[model samples]
Target: MAINVELLKKVCEAPGVPGYESKIRNMIIEEVTPLVDDISVDNMGNVIALKKGRSDEKRAMVAAHMDEIGFIVTHIDDKGFVRFTTLGGFDPKTLTAQRVVIHGKEDVIGVMGTKPVHVMTPEEKNKMPKIKDYYIDLGMNKEEVEKLIEVGNPITRERELIEMGNCVNCKSIDNRVSVFILIETLRNLKECPYDVYGVFTVQEEVGIRGANVAAHSINPDFGFGLDTTIAYDLPGASAHEKVTSLGEGTAIKIMDAMTICDYRMVDYMKKIAEENKIKWQPELLTAGGTDTAGIQRMGKSGAISGAVSIPTRHLHQVIEMANKDDIDGSINLLSNCLESLDKYDWSHK
Candidate 1:
């Protein structure tokens, strides 16, 4: 199956920082409304879309977070430079020389600026960069900047999605790509044995807040988290360091820093992928967690949980990339898994 690059592009480009996810949440609601039996937004802003199954004896929840790493305006300097604090984790060096959009009264474009290397002393040149050292230059004086910008505004990376070779690259691919995958899965999934709750969650980048709330309410029996995983298949990485590789097809999460995947779910996913002939790889990341952690344990009685992880390169940076084939495989795998949940045994091995 071919992935929808246009939809993926729109999803990846939309701005929705961790605590400020209104923009992306609205877009998700619009796109997913017609594809499910029923949909509603929670008080916490999670878009829960339910696709009724053949029977409601069991419930399955799948989470794809809509929030991305971004910045919140802290202060404006006397010369019009914008000072901000990160809304999520960031590699400090990635902020250098990047363009960002500040969602103030009006959208304002700014370039991240720091001291020029030409003027740096030897100690400064050798030291690693820090977030405090950067400020955004909006090309306007203080008076003009104050007219349109203020503290508390959300700011997001300003990169547009584009196809490169056989992959798509853009900002926010860390979790937005999974947003695309979940939307597509909801669109393609057929009748299943249990209700399928496709939840486009918010504030996942900050602490899995949205997924935690949704899971508590739904208390699903089975769960799947849709998110991207590291793909350090680059030049300097050793074979063992490559947690996953692009174009290796969708990844079946074994474990990560926050949650250890249920062994039963892992076996079920692997069995399904092999039986369906979907190419897949195992992901055992030692760092970073996804909404899976919330879905796995937040529900009453807990849930058997695993994750479908898209292999992403340059994760958390503006140049995040993922293979189109891998994305399509993710959609295929998730749709099949949701539709065939009744075929598997729930008995503990």
Candidate 2:
């Protein structure tokens, strides 16, 4: 089936900066509600949906975080300029002159401001821009800005998802794209052998906070983290350092900074993909992590864990890109794995 670009765009553009994931949470809840047997939001604002299996003998949790890397309003200066702190990881080079939305009492428009090149000293032009040196300009004076905006407000990039050649580009596609894949997988499942829990987690950008709580409460027998893996197939990156390449296929994690995937789970997914003709690629991210790391060691005896990742380029940037084919492949492989869980043995490894 062809992936829905419009739906993917809507999910990516929806505001959900770390702790403030209500809007994206609600959007996911609506899409997943009909696909699962039951659904509700957990204490940490995770949208948990359950699809009962034929026997309920085993429980499987599939996690896809809804939160995105953004900024929070830290202080507002007298000139209506706002100083902000990052809510998640960011590359300092990507911040200059980017458009952003200051999610205050009402949404306030702003732009990351910097000294114009015309007035910059030669030394300043040679040096890299610092996050500390930047502030947001909302085009309003101190008095007017104070009455409408305040500290602790969330901020997001103001880019819409768009299709270019063979890729889809947008903000928050890091994990929101994964959320879309998981929900679509469940929607296509005819039946499941093990009880399935589709968890759209919150606060992942801050520190995998929501998944920590949801895993403790549900305590599944197995877990699969659906997320985006870096695709470093760009200029100035070495072949060895490139984690995965765009359009290759869905990425299966072997290891990352935060988690080492279960060997058995990885093998199982690879076998299923080969037998079922689903395309896939192996990934080893040297930096960063995903909810899989947290969920793997979260419960009574813990759970066998793995991840299905969409290959992405320019991750954490406003115009992150991914291949449509890889997304469909991920959905297929994930759904097939969930359906065939009864045939696989988990206790041994």
Candidate 3:
């Protein structure tokens, strides 16, 4: 079960910031169409692909968000420097000195700027960063900037996917990596134990908005949020504080700020992983949430839910990294889990 690195790279590099998800959505839909029996894009912009099963069997769902954290142009100064606001969350420190593409009437390449240290007071050198301290320079005059760029144009980091020794690096890997996992799982799936819905949701960076809408319409007996969990296997982090380690395996969610994975479902996933010889690990995220939370609480009554997380490093940054082994392991584990659901007793006993 090798991950198609080429596919993952295309997904990671696509520019989609919250409200502007059409580009990423079309890419997902085009690739997913051949793998599923039926597919549709809901009004909320969720690309839902379905693989049907026995009439009497329970339905299942898997979701991965397609949106990336980025910014939108708020104003263009007289010097062609652009002021922007984040469409989703970002660590202010990572926003400095990076290049971005402003998606407008025509895509414009720009560089993020900040005051040079040569003129900064010693006290200012030690100061923290604020979004206000940054601006984007498009290298054009005020007339050229205003004539071409709109105030609401979306902006995305200029990044290329790189294959490191054991990992892949790029932007949008937070959820795009999970999107890759879902698509690959569907590609390899032979037959489903029950009807399975694979949803590529939108606006997850702003909130789990698309999932909230999709879950209600395609209510399932069980749900799985395919997403990335933090991997803090670097220096200065204690053992327990490291949510997950890269290359160890696919992460089985136990709990996160948004949802505590159903204990029975957690055991079910672990059982399949062991049976299939797929590497697996447990994750406990301290903050942030996933579409799993939305599906778990959708409709009048919730459904059984859990998440399969790819362990990622440098989350919400320009250089998000995911292990190749983890990607392969997740595809295998999730495919097996989906195929085994019909016979597996979801009962509490």
Candidate of highest TM-score: 1
Query: What's the lDDT for residue 22 in model 3?
Result: 93
Could you estimate the TM-score for every candidate?
0.99, 0.98, 0.98
Q: CA RMSD for every model?
A: 0.7, 1.1, 1.1
- Which candidate has the highest lDDT of all? 1
| Per-residue accuracy of model 3 over 188-281 as CA lDDT, tens digit each | 8887768999999989989899999999998888899999989999999999999999999999999999898999899999999988888899
- Residues 153-236 of candidate 1: C-alpha lDDT, one tens digit per residue: 999999999999999999999899999999999988878889999999999989999999999999999999999999999999
Better of 1 and 3 by lDDT: 1
Name the runs in model 3 displaced over 4 angstroms.
Answer: none
Single out the weakest 10-residue window by summed lDDT for candidate 1: 312-321
Evaluation by lDDT, superior candidate among 1 and 2: 1
Local distance difference test scores for all models = 0.94, 0.89, 0.90
lDDT of 1 at 132: 96
lDDT tens per residue, model 2, 1-349: 6898888988989999999998898898888887889999988899999999997877999999999999998998878899999989888788888999988778888889888989999999999988898899988999989987889988999999888888888888888899889888888887898899999999988888988888898898899999999999999999998899998998899989999999989999999999999888999988888999778988676889999988999987766889999999999999999999888876673
- Name the regions of candidate 2 deviating beyond 4 angstroms: 347-349
Q: By how many angstroms RMSD does model 2 differ from the true structure? A: 1.1
Better of 2 and 3 by lDDT: 3
